[model samples]
Target: MANRWLRPEVYPLFAAVGAAIGICGFQLVRNICINPEVRVSKEGRAAGVLENYAEGEKYAEHGLRKYLRNKTPEIMPSINSFFADPNRS
Candidate 1:
């Protein structure tokens, strides 16, 4: 009866879910360890007054944000470029 669950149709669903969960887990771990805003130790905490909140935010940017920082913010760049004439100044 358990063999009924082994059908080929469910493999992609399984892989997709696994990949999503794995990516989430990896980002979670990465944030917990590397993100400067997330301090795990007592010693890691700031003791004195600091004014550079943006500095911590600078280092705290997630993977996706870092990747998209330089790239144009668009849903479909190719399509937009095709519709937008380059001659218009």
Candidate 2:
């Protein structure tokens, strides 16, 4: 009976082959099904479906205002100090 499993160099070869197969499989799936699908919404309210730059800016400003209005008291000191820094260039 031959004991082929005793070879120490076979482990690296097996690992390399497994890594190659995994990478090739990942690339194949990414090329076929992982692509981004861009669909424009008729109602203009779906997530990640902004229609124009103006709408995006409006959303951003609204979000910032909401955050500032609801921010925690502990964070207020840091925020105030950042704006009050006269030496800021």
Candidate 3:
């Protein structure tokens, strides 16, 4: 009877089936999204999968700034600022 489908035991079974199916589908999606093999770039191409130009530019700028910051100038600051008495003549 149609009323049998509305029984309490049937609802729990249906709920369990729906939850299992939902979890399975979610896992499949997560695996596809996070799996390195599945998230690969085009065949033999040099470009990255995300194609994030801003990230690349940020790294480039960071490297340039770091290089300039660590490089020493030819002259020392103390020698350049040494006092010379012009009135000694």
Question: What are the RMSD figures for all models against the true structure?
Answer: 4.4, 14.2, 22.0
In model 2, how large is the Cα lDDT of residue 11? 83
TM-score, structure 2 vs. true:
0.34
Stretches off by above 4 angstroms in model 2 are 36-89
Per-model TM-score versus the true fold: 0.58, 0.34, 0.39
Put down candidate 2 lDDT per residue, 3-79, tens digits, no spaces.
58647778899899899999999867754543333333444335664456674555356655877787666657877
lDDT values, one for every candidate: 0.79, 0.63, 0.65
Write one digit per residue (lDDT tens) for candidate 1, span 1-89. 76787789889998999999999999899789766566777776754444677867776675678898999989998788878978655
**Candidate 3 on 6-41: residue-level lDDT in tens?**
888799999999999999998689556654434445
The residue pairs that clash in candidate 1, if any, are: none
In candidate 3, where is summed lDDT lowest over 10 consecutive residues? Answer: 80-89
Candidate 1 contains a number of clashing pairs equal to 0
